[model samples]
Target: MAYECLFTSPRCVFFTFTLLNQLLPSILGATYHSHDVTSDTVCNRYHKRELQVYMSDPVILETRPESAHMLTLGLSLSCTFEMEAKGFYTTGVVSVVQSMNFRSHGDNCLDYMQTIYEDEDNDMKLKRKKSKKKKILKKVVKAAVLSRRRRDTDDEDGRGPRICGRVLFGLQVDENETLPPPFADPLPPTKPDQGVLSSLFWDAPNPYQSLVSDAAEVDHKGEIKTRLHISNRMLRQNEDVNLKVVYTAYQECDGRRVPESLFHCGYGLCISRSLVNDGLVNCPFGDCADEVDCASAKEANIIAKVLHYERTDETSVWWIILWVLVGLVLMFLACCGGIFLFMRRRKH
Candidate 1:
């Protein structure tokens, strides 16, 4: 007998697995050496195929800027995707877009023109003869008029316009199979300063900061959706910016529940909240549990004492009854000894 399973989704890749089973009837009194012979054979035959077809049609669909017009420097964007399998995946995308460099231009262009004209007039009077004074004055007047007209045309409200420059936007996605990173995985280790362009602009507090790293999860239907919130300080007015999203997909077979604290042991293991500060080494490495969570030896000792007391409380009543029975038996023996003494005295 043969069986075929088909999985499909829109904007998602589909994977198909085929299994073949052949069972033979046993004769009377025949002995079977292995119970898993058929299953083992089937697995051996299809293992490579299963791995090859596991992920198919994985793609990033759209990368779009959230707004076309921004008064400040902040920017926002979103990336949507479809994947073949549900698992852990990671991707880094970067976009280079134009933004206004407000610091490059002065507020008043008229003041700047006046300073240039006065300096030029003083230099010309000192260098020129009387015969050439009229010609020099005519040339200066013509040049000043042209400069004023150009400045007026450029600055409509008497303030100079801002200059534009290219800005780099970056986003990183790290996702888990069962739960989102916030719930399933520990906070990633702090990154070192590698002197890359992205690292130079990665600011923690500023939303319009050039680089951002985030995590996301693929849904059951093999899709991932996420948004990036940008600061108004990162953008220019009515500017169109480019966006790009890159990604990679893989699978995780371990079936471990993520703890509330979301700490991981680095080797695909989750650290239990109960085990933290309990003195016992739950994580394979000290750093995996985080230095702050595992810092105090006194906390672990206190936790151990509390656990011991809890166990003692559970059996306290039984222990009390046993001790009372022993005490009563000793009392009965004493009474018997006293009665024997009195009987001996009376006999005498």
Candidate 2:
């Protein structure tokens, strides 16, 4: 009966983790629910492709690595993406990985992990999870057993489960797999001062100024969609003599931490500055006299537009004051009526 009631109630019925339980108190109105992520992670263009990529490879950053975008496991990778979204993570030597399309799957996972510790009992914490489903545990053991036999058979007809960590042969390979140093990943050889760019790309709190080694820059207009750093209003209004732009990278495990090492983003030790003002990218490719001089009224209109604000907040404190006054008046009337009734009872 209890089990039947659980399913009947909306609280217990959830697709992934998008559940609202009547019996449980949610933290800050945020409910922890499991979401299925697969099809939602990648586009349909990669439907037929199978990719063989190395395990433990860093996700490529520049040009948006295919591995970074797609969500898959060995079985899920084999099958077409079945769901809209999901929240599965992988464990690595230096990082735990999370990937998704529209939403922040990483922080959602981290927040869920934090909820586990809220119990205050240390024993209740999660150990590393090994299996994605009930059945995979058996396949993993079988694969291990097969791996041992591969040494004797010459790996031709009947060796074992040939599960290359990424995928099988002729599968879609994401070229943006990040290979780091010690294995000859193409990066500018690091000098003593070369460590500066590390902070910029990693989770360093501030941007590194005075870059000497990395000078080449890519100022993209409407090309780069994922904005790394957003400038504060103070930086824009203060009009500092020179404001520096800091480009940052999100950690695969958590968006907060500075990655110990980053995968391929094309150039290593590249000093990058975030471009904010349109003026920085407004270099018109033309002749000498054709350029409109910005020293006139046209420049004034441009300046005016920058300073102009189109929207105004509608709320005002006067409404609150009026409501409070009405509440006090009603309370006073109730008190006077109570006193009159008490006097009439005493007289009677």
Clashes of 2: 13
The C-alpha RMSD in Å for every predicted model, in order, reads 34.0, 25.4
Q: 86-160 in candidate 2: lDDT tens per residue?
A: 112211111111111121123221111000001112432222122335245445443443443312332344321
Tens digit of per-residue lDDT, candidate 1, span 133-168: 356545654444344332233333222222122211
What is the overall TM-score of model 1 with all chains considered together?
A: 0.18
Residue runs of model 1 more than 4 Å from their true location after superposition: 1-57, 62-212, 215-223, 227-238, 253-348
> lDDT per model, in order?
0.26, 0.22
Model 2: weakest 10-residue lDDT segment is: 109-118
Judge candidate 2 against the unseen true structure and give its global Cα lDDT, from 0 to 1.
0.22
